[model samples]
Target chain A: MTITGKNKNKAVVESVAQIIFTVCASFAILAVASITLYMILSGTPAIFKVGLKEILFGTVWKPTAAEPKFGILYVILTSVVGTMLAILIGVPVGILTAVFLAEVADKRIARIVKPAVELLAGIPSVIYGLLGIYLLNPLMYKLELKIFAGSTTHQFTGGANLLSAVLVLAIMILPTVINISETSIRAVPPSIKAASLALGASHIQTIFRSILPAAKSGIVTAIVLGVGRAIGEAMAITLVSGSSVNAPLPFNSVRFLTTAIVSEMGYSQGTHRQMLFTIGLVLFVFIMLINIALTKILKKGAAEDGE
Target chain B: MGNDTLYQKRKRPGEAFLMAAIYGAASIAVLLLLGIIGYVFFKGFRVLNPAFLTTVTSSLKGTVGIAGNLLNTLYIIAITLLIATPIGVGGAIYLNEYAKPGKLVNLIEFTTETLSGIPSVIFGLFGMVFFGNVLGLGYSLLNGSLTLTLMVLPLIVRNTQEALRTVPDSYRSGALGMGATKWYMIRTILLPSAKPGILTGVILAVGRIVGESAALLFTAGSARILPKLGTNLVENLSRIGGKILQPGGTLTIELYLQMQNGEYEVAFGIGCVLLVIVLLINLLLKVITGNARKYGKQ
Candidate 1:
């Protein structure tokens, strides 16, 4: 093809347009990256000034008090324990649901179940929080789990404890696990099932031994994604976590890094505010590491599957 | 025959138990939806009177309507769609129509994917620094809308690209063969074909915008009353460059604030309203896409 003047000009314009779009998209990524960088860079000095042991191990979070301590061990524990609890509750149910959708359910039932999961995913966290406040809180009180030890007043009522946050987080992450697990299970080759069946294996045996084994890495990725979501979740945890900065015991009402950021960002100023940024930075690093790890694992899984 | 009998014996109870468990877990997903809808309606219905829809929230008990917040949510959706749809669609077109697979396109794809992964709270923080402080837009609807625009742009671009890619290449080739220019072929052949997908993207974006709480908390500062049509629009626009830049409280924010203040009844009521709106939008998308499919089949 001959390069005419008109064609050359058009090529120039198209290249320019592509460059501009690429830059715009790059800016969006940079926006997120810059936020993470700013949080870490600005927050580290405080972390250093306060000492890592004081920041991570100290019990108190009194950033504004005369003896300002910024220990985050409790918050970190709350997040990790809450996420673990969520995974414990959510993973089995989600895996079962995915197995059912992939292996047993009729097409008509699968269709209904699929969209229901989508709707579940789409329901906003605010509504989840509202439900927790109205339904879960009262239920906890009625179960006598709200009262601490022998207290009769039920004033504590476990209004926002590790249990409630974990339960909510479990529900929030369910769709993530279910969707991914279902897709992975469906991707398992029918030939594997056929071979197992030929060997006189039952459908159940085939699924557990042959199909699930093949989809294991994908299933792991799904669980990791769920953990990431549970760790980063804010609004639902905020409403249900009770937002107390006091070092959280297992039954005590507590705050995660996210809930702390949301609850304190409005009123906090000075170093107190910067510390909140530090908290955010902590959460950001935590989630970013999870995301990158998941991505790498997923890529390797894909490569292995391709082989 | 003996082997088959043995396999059947081994499989029957185990398969039955596993299948039952799977079905039980699947049913819970449906039950969760029912639980959410039922709880919201049960609590919210007690306070969902006509006054709640028509009047602004007041200091008086039993009169705290969400009319203003509803309007604010609507305004944010409108402004965000206005800003996001064009740019998002345009970017998608540039990717699909003009660009070849190169470093730039790959970079854009990577960036958009990463953007989608960032948590909303981070977006809130960025909005605070960039829009609120640096840009001097302060906490206003325009700032919130802009922040949301960035948040949803990747969704729009990805969806639009998928839609455009789904359009058969033959259509474009035929249009070009008929002496149509590249731009004309795209305008006439590609976009129209991808209309349903683009609209689906818009619907999804609206759902995110309406349900968003954290990002807007910083950008669109809390204001109880709806802005008036004339001076308010002007003042808001001038403040944020003729955009929706007033201190607006969306339903999500109102719901959060109400729950925070221990107004369970009102929060539930607002929650129901938001749920209904989202459901309706979803239903609209289904109907529209259903019709489009029907028409295409015809």
Candidate 2:
């Protein structure tokens, strides 16, 4: 009778512990749900007040005028353009660097280059902002004076503009694309390379035609990740993109979706603050789409590896 | 003749061009890294001194100090790690040790992945609204700490889960065979074995906290004042405790403000300090994990 009671007590304690653990493990789900819920609850009312068409498609963004306008079409356009440009510049360099590390470089060179890339990844975004301000801005300013010196248009062609933002973003996205692509290239099967070599293909030809084609999914995933980083980035772009809402010309100062929310969050109130949250909602949806793509690609890669 | 011709095939111009391009790209990446580091150090080293590290900002004295921000960074780090570590480790334990393979587990894992991918600016927005306004913390260090806890929790959980998986199953069975409860086995055998990983996660979280600016800017209002400690030990302790609920800026925010104010030299100094801290933490991580690897073999 005593032994049976002891066993029952032990079982009871064990079961209670399990219950506690289950609750703890659920915190991730809880956090995600709460963040999503909070964002939607706070972010949607502004969309209704501003009207979806005016908020999304309208061009003006006069939030504190006598009659307020809350259009984000230009902001969205700038983010897309800047990100697209960053990818165009970053992808080729990143992929080429990865190709060097994976296929061409000697071991010593690879070792040195690898850690440098990791360090690049670890540098804080603010530092990137600081560098952009200190270095890229001035260079662009001189270039602006030269290019538009004799032109008639009165443009504020200072260094801190869309082109500056694009350059900084391109550099920032390099580590993400390079690291992922390098790993994927390394994962390519040796047998395929051997087959190509046996078929009288040169090393470069084999790498381009066989290894790269085989690792296409991973390289695509890397590019997608780079695009996401470029679009979502705010602080560096905020510093260099001049924080003005304008058409995304090479010389014109432009505000991205991210910088728009951050630049005004401090002073904004009422419907204006609500609009910032609405912008946050838009950014959230963009991120969610990227995350979904990442997950799908990763799953596909894993399945392919399994086969 | 076929074998001889195949062996004697000359390198094509295209091959040479591709290789040169590859090398050029690699060189450019390395040069960029070196240039940034060299430039920061060259400029920052000139202004870095005892006065800058120790003093507080004084417009009248024409002096700038990051002492308050330094302390605030430490406070935020301590508070964030203290809360995040236990909760994170607990969650990992439940996921790795206790939970059965099922929908709930997968759901938790999926949510964790989703949480990590959400950008810092969004976290800043949420913290500004939820923590700053709704919680009535009103842009305090405590509010920032709470926000960061949420941000770093997934990182800690992922690291701890990875660590727990590395523990040999034999160790668990051995502890349980000796009449120990499951919790006892975990506390004694599993945790000790996974110490390196848990520590790594915590340290990496510390690095993230130190480097963080966006979330803190909203949650922790960038007040540059030092916490007012009284003239006694007990009073000072209470004052320090009280400071957690007050607005404070950290090093990164200070860096941002300095740059904004055109305090270029001071900003570079802070940047150098940040770089040094990152390097040190990375080294410490490597040492700890190296030791852990050695211990694992035994």
Candidate 3:
């Protein structure tokens, strides 16, 4: 076709449209960059002022005491243990459920169970909080009373403690684990299962030996995502945990990194406020680490699949 | 029994045990949902009344209700979607149709995933700093919606991308062969087909915004009152605009507050309302996705 004035106009419009689209696409990058920059800007000043050791190692977190101390050692430990424990409880049940959905369940059962799982996933975190408060906390308090009967550990804040938080986290992370794990489990090559079964392996053996082993990377990713979910959980945790910065004993009222920020951000000012941002920064670092590890696992999985 | 077991159909104890565990685990997931939903509906049923649904909390009249919170939640969902959908759709178009495989494209995709992974609390904190204070929107519906816009952007983008991907390449080729421009092909063909998926994404985003609380806590000050409005038509329209700038607590935030204030009755009621809303959302999603699947086959 011959180049003409109208054609030039069309060419210019296309390029301009492309530019606008590119800018639109870059918004995600812009958002991530700004979040990181702001986090560093707002979070680092507190770290420098408080000394990283004092903040991370200091056990006393009396932010509003006569002489305020801003240690988050207990806070860090609570998050670490809470996340780990939740992972332990959630992963098994979640993986087994995935196996059922992917390998065992009939179509009718899967159809019924699938929507329920999605609804569970859809339930608000705060509703989880409500459940924790009413259902789990009371049961925990009764258990605590029995276990610590005649002991001088005054059970304050009812049953809101580390254990309750963990249970809540476990339940909350279920949807993530089950969905991702199930998808990966289904993606396992049918040939692998067939081969294993043909080699005189039982059906259960084929699933455990061939299917799960093949789907390990996706399962691992699901677990990592679950950890991320548990670690950064705020609303359900804030309501469930006893909101005090304590060592993460099973029954102690404790605070996770995310809850520390949410509980204090409302009224906190100056250094107290900035330290809350520091907690966010700490939480951010943990999530980034998790994200990095996930990338490594996924890349390795892909490379292995290639081989 | 030993040699025949290898070739014969035999069940190991381990197999039975593993099978039991799988069934049991699936049951737990189902039970948890049933238990929570059942509990909320049971508790909230006692407290829910027509009056409870229709009025705001007024100390002078001594009426406590979630009307204000319900409205605020509706408003936030509307405003957030308004801001997020166009940008998200545009971004997805760029990703799926226009952009070549390159560093920038990969970076965008990675960031989108990261955004989804990032917790709401961080978004709340960032919103409190940037949008709430520095941007001078303060703790208002608009400010909260902006924060939520970021939170739900990934949903829209990913869903739109999936929808766009499902569109056959032949449509694009045919359009271009007919001398249509790239933008024309996308506008006339890709987007219309992608509408169902985009709608699904929007519905999902709505569900998220309805459920979200942590992000709104600091960014949107939890003021549980109806915003002021004008009486006359001209003034009423202007006042609706004014409502956008006022601080309002959504249903979830108000639920948290009620829980804090030891108002279990109200809290349970709010949770029940939220559950019902969630049920409705899931139903909508099921309908759209089922329709999309049916359409896909044809």
Measured against the true structure, the TM-scores of the candidates, in listed sequence, are 0.90, 0.95, 0.97
Model 1 lDDT per residue over A25-71, tens place: 45555666666666666567767677778877877887778878788
**What does DockQ give for each predicted structure?**
0.47, 0.64, 0.79
Name the runs in model 2 displaced over 4 angstroms: A1-9, B1-4, B296-298
Candidate 2 lDDT by residue in tens digits, B199-243? 999988998898888778878978887876668999899898999
Candidate 3 C-alpha lDDT tens digits along B248-269 = 9999999999998889999999
Residue pairs in candidate 2 whose N, alpha carbon or C atoms collide under 3 angstroms: B55-B65
Candidate 3 per-residue C-alpha lDDT over A1-307 given as tens digits, one digit per residue, 9 for 90 to 100: 5669879888899888888888888999999898888888889898888899999999999888778899999999999999999999999999999999999999999999988988999999999998898889999999988888888756565899999999999999999999999999999988999999999788899999899999999999999999989998999989789878888989999999998888888788788999999999998888878877887888898998899
Question: How far out, in Å, is residue A107 in model 3?
Answer: 0.6
The per-model lDDT (C-alpha) reads 0.82, 0.88, 0.91
Error of 2 at B114 (Å): 1.1
Docking class of 2: medium
| Order by TM-score, highest first | 3, 2, 1
Better of 1 and 3 by lDDT: 3
List the candidate 1 regions with Cα displacement exceeding 4 Å.
A1-20, A142-148, A151-157, A246-249, B1-8, B11-14, B60-62, B177-181, B229-243, B292-298
Q: What's each prediction's clash count?
A: 3, 1, 0
Single out the weakest 10-residue window by summed lDDT for candidate 1 chain B: B237-246
